[model samples]
Structures are given as structure tokens and as C-alpha cells.
Target: MATTPPVIQAKITSDPVKLPLAPLLVSVVVGVVVATAGVGGMICYLLRSGKVPIRVAGVAPVVPTAPLKTHMVALEPLLVNLADPSGSAFLRAGITLSIEDPAEDKGKETNAGEAKPSSKDADAALRDTALTVLGQQTSDQLLAANGKERLKAELKSALAEHNPTVKVADLFFTEFLVQR
Candidate 1:
């Protein structure tokens, strides 16, 4: 028997994929540009809509005008008997008044003949008004929960009525004592 030679088959190879360089690069560039434009548009929209705040450099921030200057006038302590039935209750209170500084009014024009009251006279008037109001408060009224606040309000009103020239911005109780 004769041996037959084995048949050899040729190998077939496929070509690699080819991409157009110009179009690929153009598409990539276009995509990047579109994304950048979209982000910039969104930022502008937010800013225009006031959703994003813009701060300017080297600009002084808005500052509110300084509050008007105030002067504190402390009054002498008062020892007054209360309107209690037994007439034995008493109140010892130290108070201070906050008023607008008189120096601020220097620019205002006043009559040449008009004279302002002296500090002593003003202080005496304040003391008299405070004593009158305090003397009317009974021990029960002064001992209540809102006693101090009520007393302050009353004092302020009384002072305003009795001394119109002196504007009391606020009243403070430095010391308070009650005896029955």
C-alpha cells in the first residue's frame, strides 16, 4: 500500500478595523466644546437668576450707620414708703437713665434768649417724679412676677410727662430692695 501525503491548508487573516482620523478628532473636539458651552450657559443662567451671588473684590461691604450716641445719667437711690395698708412696706431702688447725648444737638439752632435747665434741676425733677411713682406702688404689686417691668414702664411714662425736655431712651434698675 502507498502512503498519501497530508494536504496543507493556507491560513486566511482578516484586516484590522480602520477609523477616519479627521472625523474622529472633529467629533471629540465638538463634544468637548459643546460640554464647555453648556456648563458656561448654566453658570450664566444661575447668575442672572440671582441664584448665584457675585461678590466684587475691594468693595467695602455695606455698613450700617453708627447708632446714635447715648448718655447715662445715674440717679440717687430712693427710699420710699409703699401704699400698703399697714404703711410699713418700703422700697429702696437705685436707677440709671439712658438719654440721647446733648452734644449731638449742638448743631440745631436755638433762640438766643432761651435757657436750658441746669443738670441739678433736671436731676431733682427726675428724683421727684420717681419718688412719686414709687410711693404709689404697694408691696403686693411690687412683689408680683411682672412687677419690675410694670414699674419701669410707669416710671418711663411719668418721666416723659414730668420732664419733656429730657428724653429717656431706657431705664435700668441698678439696685432694688423691698421691706415689709
Candidate 2:
């Protein structure tokens, strides 16, 4: 005789089943998001705590300068000889200069209380300049029609050097004499 196979039974339960891992997984994800948000907040707070300073440049100064002082005096006369290839000639020289000081010129002190000159400063200065220039003068230079003018320039420069305190601005000729 063949024995019959045992019968299997199927049953359905009405009670709810608990999923243990689902809540733990959700908590871990939320924790990670919270930690990231906390770190971002900390970084923002640190940045806001630091200080940044600003700087600027560009400034100008304001001031004025004083003008120079000058004076002029008439020259006596200058006689120069020409150094020409053909022959010798004569030149008359005259000039005026803008001296820094009028006192350098020879004259009576206009001030009523001023004393007379103890030393011949003016005469000496003039003579010195004249001789220096006359010694170096040439016939060609003196023979020209404008010889007086050229002499005046040299005289002015020389006189000015002699009278450093006095500036020789210009030269003039009141009397001229030239003989060939």
C-alpha cells in the first residue's frame, strides 16, 4: 500500500510587523544633513568676525615763491682797439647795467645822514673791469660800426662780475670816439 503525502497549511496574521532598520537609516541621514548645516554656519560666523580696513592716497601742497630783486646803474666809458688784418683802429664803448645794489656805483650818498666814501670801491671796480676788457679787445672787434654795442656787452658782463652784488642789465653810450 502507498502512503499519502502530508498536507501543508497556509495562514495570514492580522498583527502589524515592525521594520527595525528603516528608522535608524532615516535618523542617520538627518544627522548627516544637520552636521553639514552646523559646519556651514560655523564658517559663516568666523568670516563675519574678521575685520577689513580701507586706505586712500593722493594729496597736494599749496605755497608761493618770492620774486628776485635787481638794480641798474650807468657805465662810464670803454675804449677798445681793433685787431684787423690790414691795420689798427679805435672803438668807443659805453654801457649800463642792472646792478643788484646802487650803492656799488660811485656817487655822493643821497641820504642826508650818510657819510662820505672812505675807500674808492666804485672807482676801483670800474677801472678793473675796463682794463680787463680793454686788454683782451681786438681791432676787428673794435672797428665795426656796432663796436660800441659789442664793447657795452663785454663791459656789462665784466662789470657785473666785478660787482657781484650789482647786476649789469644793459649798457649805453653817451659819448663815443673812434679814430683809425
Candidate 3:
């Protein structure tokens, strides 16, 4: 008959067990994904709250427009020196002012009736305004790409200031010649 051997006690360790590399990596990835999702949700909530006035897609603002009754008043040719110090460059421009239709203002239906202001007064005012603007511009300014359009805008403003009641709809350059 064989005798049974006595069992020995196993020793316990104080150090923690090492975790598997795969599971640790998976936990880190999950934590990052959860944090990113939380941040994105917060941003969406703030945007929807309308505390900020973010413009929505496919929405356009309204603009007011004036009635379209236009008439042109031709001004005589203007010759003026440019802003250049040596007076080497000059501008000769023939401008036409698009004024409000007199027929519309008077509520009359006439074919060839002249506008209210005398031709002499209107011509002088328009010519003076145009000459002042053209004379102030340098050769470089006149030759620039958007120079003509800028000058037209400035002239329109000046015309408005000169005659408040006169609605100058647009400015047309019948002849624009710049000599340098």
C-alpha cells in the first residue's frame, strides 16, 4: 500500500498582475472615441441654441429697389490735369447723367418735354463735379483696372450732394480718354 504525501502551502505575492497589451490598447481607443463624440455633441447643441447668429444655408437677405424711370442729361467734354506733380497726365471725359424722368415726376405723358432744371444750370453743375473728381485722380488711378467704375461712383455721389432732389440714376462715359 502506498502512503499519500502531505500538501504544502503556496506563497502569495503583493505585486499586481500584468494586464494584456491587446486589452489595454482597446480600452485606450474606446476612451478616446467616447471623448471625441461627447465634444462633438456639445458643439452641435450650442449651434442649435441660436446664441450665435450663424447664417443658415440657402437663405438670402432682402434688398430694396427703386422704380425704373431714367433719363440722361449730357454734359460737355471736360479737360483737367491729373494729380501728377509735373502735370504730365490729363483726363478728357464726356459724361452723361441719368436723371429721374421728368414725365414721371409731373405725372404727365409727353413725348419730348424737357426736364425741369435749365440746361445751362444742370450742365454747369455736372461739369464742375466731374472735373473736380477727374482732376483729383492720378495717372496710376485712372489706368487701374477698376478706376473708371470708381470714378463713376464718386461722380454719382458728388452729383447727389450738389442736387439732393435730383436723382442721378447712373453715370455714363460717352468718351473716356486718359493722356499720359
Candidate 4:
């Protein structure tokens, strides 16, 4: 028996094989197809839902309101003596208010169906109500830069209760004096 073995029969090649491009092309095609499908689905969903505009509660625009007519009414000065003996001083103050819808008396006689409200009536009511409120409020309440603001709001609320149609726009302290 020969121990050397048989001669080689296969051929030897050294050339490099080219890799297939099909895998990269398939990946690109799949990505494009998925992206298009996702976009188309989103658009179809939006259109099928009817697309009604959203409404936010308490965010509606307020319609313009009618302008109220204003009239200024002047009041007599009020004097107040402090209750405390140590800080006993008298304060004198006059108040004027810009009132809206003052009750007025037209000379023209109305038919049996008359007796509607007048500007003068509204003005008089506002003046009386304002004077009462100011009288009750102390000088500190009426005189303080910030406290005066509170007094104004209180006055408006007070007036509104008595006269619904009449509105108090502003309070003008024409004169404020103190004496010992």
C-alpha cells in the first residue's frame, strides 16, 4: 500500500466575489412603504372624524356692551368728631360722584301711562346713599391712599343694591379738612 496519498484534483481561485445589492435595496423600499402608509393612515383618520373646531369654556369673547351715561352730583360736607378723648379731632369732607342714569323730571306731562324713572331721582338717590356710606367710614378709611379704594368699592355695592339702573362710576373728594 502506498502511504503518499493521491494527487490534488480541485482548482485553486484567488479572485474576490462581489456582494449582492438586493438586501440594501429591499430595506430602502420597505422603509419608504411603511412611512407612506403611516402618513396616509393619519390623514385618513383626521378627515373621517369630521374635524370640528374645539371650544374652550370660559374663553368666549364678550360682546360689546352699551355705554352708560354719567352725571356728577355734589354733596354737602360732613363733620365728624373722634370718639377717643386723647386723639379728639374733627374731620370735614365733601364728596362728589359720577353717576349714570340720573333721574330727571321732564316738564312735558305724560299720559296716564307716565311715572317712569328720572335722572334726578337716580342722582339724588346716589348722593344720599354715598353720603351715608362716607359718613360711616372713618377718615382713615376715606383718606388712606389704599383704604380709599376699599371705600369706593363699598360705595358702589351699596348704591347698586338700592338703585339697579343707576351706576356710580367714580367718587371725587373735592374737599377734606381736619380741625382740633
lDDT of 1 by residue, 19-72 (tens): 989999999999999999999999999999999999889999898985655567
Of the two candidates 2 and 3, the one with more favorable lDDT, higher being better, is 3
Q: Summing lDDT over every window of 10 consecutive residues in candidate 3, give the lowest-scoring window.
A: 102-111
> Which residue ranges in model 3 land beyond 4 Å of their true spot?
1-67, 102-106, 112-117
What is the lDDT for 39 in model 4?
A: 95
Is 2 or 3 the stronger prediction by TM-score? 3
lDDT of 3 by residue, 73-146 (tens): 88888888999877899988888878876544656554667654546776777777778888899988878999
Kindly report which residue pairs in candidate 4 clash with one another.
102-119, 103-118, 103-119, 103-120, 103-121, 103-122, 104-118, 104-119, 104-120
Please, what is the TM-score per model? 0.60, 0.40, 0.58, 0.43
Error of 3 at 79 (Å): 0.9
**Cα RMSD (Å) between model 3 and the true structure?**
7.2
Decoy 1 TM-score against native: 0.60
Query: What is candidate 1's local distance difference test score?
Result: 0.90
Q: Ten-residue segment with the worst summed lDDT in candidate 2?
A: 100-109
Q: lDDT of all predictions, in order shown?
A: 0.90, 0.63, 0.82, 0.68
Winner of 3 and 4 under lDDT: 3
Find the candidate with the highest TM-score and give its number.
1
Candidate 4, superposed: residue stretches over 4 Å from native: 1-62, 82-87, 102-128, 139-145, 161-166, 178-180
- Collision pairs in model 1: none
RMSD of every prediction: 10.7, 18.9, 7.2, 9.9
Candidate 4: deviation at residue 37, Å?
A: 26
